[model samples]
Target: MKRVEGRVALVTGAAQGIGLAVAQRLKEEGAIVVMSDLNAAALQEAARRLDADAIVQDVASEQGWIDTMRSIREAHGALHILVNNAGIEGDPSAPKDPQGAPLTDWNKIFTVNSAGVFLACKHAITLMSESGGGSIVNVSSIASLVPTPFLTAYGAAKASVQHLTQSVALHCATSGYRIRCNSVHPGQARTPMLEALFERMARQAGASVEQFTAAFVAQIPMGSLQEPEDVANLVLFLASDEARYITGQAIACDGGYVLAH
Candidate 1:
């Protein structure tokens, strides 16, 4: 039998980039994938291509979480995997100083990136518990592990996700649920979000996006931008039985950026 056969997984931010790739990977591994995002049309198109289900969601809201969980429970009858992939990089124009980030900007980052994951975990854990336990893979960033002086808000928000994953793992295990919570930190992937972020940074630096990308890649020991599939493959492993023993960990699929840097 295929690994994850008959399993039901819900991946947020499934309209594009890493979220899209993760949804495709899970479906390929025999999971009944449900892709959700704020973009109804784009998400529906993506889901059609992947042969997965689609739901509209905004992870930062409690009502959004409640509605999504109810939809999954009623439609699929069980939830096995939850990939908390929805998030934003905030504004590239924001101040770099961790403290200098305006409260508004900081709140925006936390609301979507950190609190979104927390809310997803809160709801997903309940469904997973009823389904006899499951796996949750949170998409974080390598910046959480390293200094992200240029994007302090994004960095701190992801760091919070790392800690939240750990906390959820403890709750699930201690409660005798067969659940695992882990974070996957990707570094310098050629995704739309990263492209947009770098484009903004490049503009500020008065350099071409090409130049910025080259400079960024040069810092990675792997000497290249990781494809979205590489990160999705890692999520696949973490969601599978092979990683049954792993939980409460933040794994980096950064092409060695975390270690070499």
Candidate 2:
């Protein structure tokens, strides 16, 4: 109920999926939200629909964060929330050469997933510290905690994000800043990315998408997949004053999927 009222939030990759859900949730809770994404058209449309500010950007670029922070300062006066949610699925389930991936693939994965998060946190801390501190939530994945075949690069990148959150939190604490940093790991959420992944798996296994989904769901003790809103709810809490004392932790909104195996 308006827990984030009067706050200013910037959500990267806000064109769709979990990022879009988080932006909407923050706005609904009364925060002035700025949505950014690489897809300019989609970002514009989403911003129009949600009535939030939009910035088309490649989060991996250093200048992207600079321009974004400048815009935020001009429009919102200060930053209160930064949700680093931009990422890519990286390589396909079966690559051309599974045993030996190209260095390009590895670099691209780390560039967007890990480097983007670092850039956001770096600039966010500067603005947040000036404004009496803020909150930062880095969206990680359950793959970071467990073994993930064919997604080695993605898993490694997310693992770095988890540790990055802890380091940022500790630095802020030691510096006497009120800012908080944490990571959220979601497993098998029903987003477009997951849908495409399921479809790919279905084709590879010679099964229908529904069948593949059902089989996957069976592995989760909760017997269900999470929705983007479910993760967004937790993000809202962490962005709000309710989670003021919480920082430097990796929390899972995985519907018990991570524990099933």
> Judged by TM-score, which candidate is best?
1
lDDT of 2 by residue, 1-261 (tens): 689999899999999999999999999999999999999999999999999999999999999899989999999889999999999977664352346666678788899999999999987898998888989999999989887765777888899999999999999989987899999999988898899888887888899999999999998888899999999999999999999999999999987887865
Show the lowest summed lDDT stretch of 10 residues, model 2: 93-102
Instruction: Note the Cα lDDT for every prediction shown.
Output: 0.91, 0.91
Model 1 CA deviation exceeding 4 Å by range = none
Collision pairs in model 1: none
Q: What is the TM-score of each candidate against the true structure?
A: 0.97, 0.96
Query: Where does candidate 2 stray beyond 4 Å?
Result: 93-98
The C-alpha RMSD of each candidate to the native structure, in angstroms, is: 1.1, 1.5
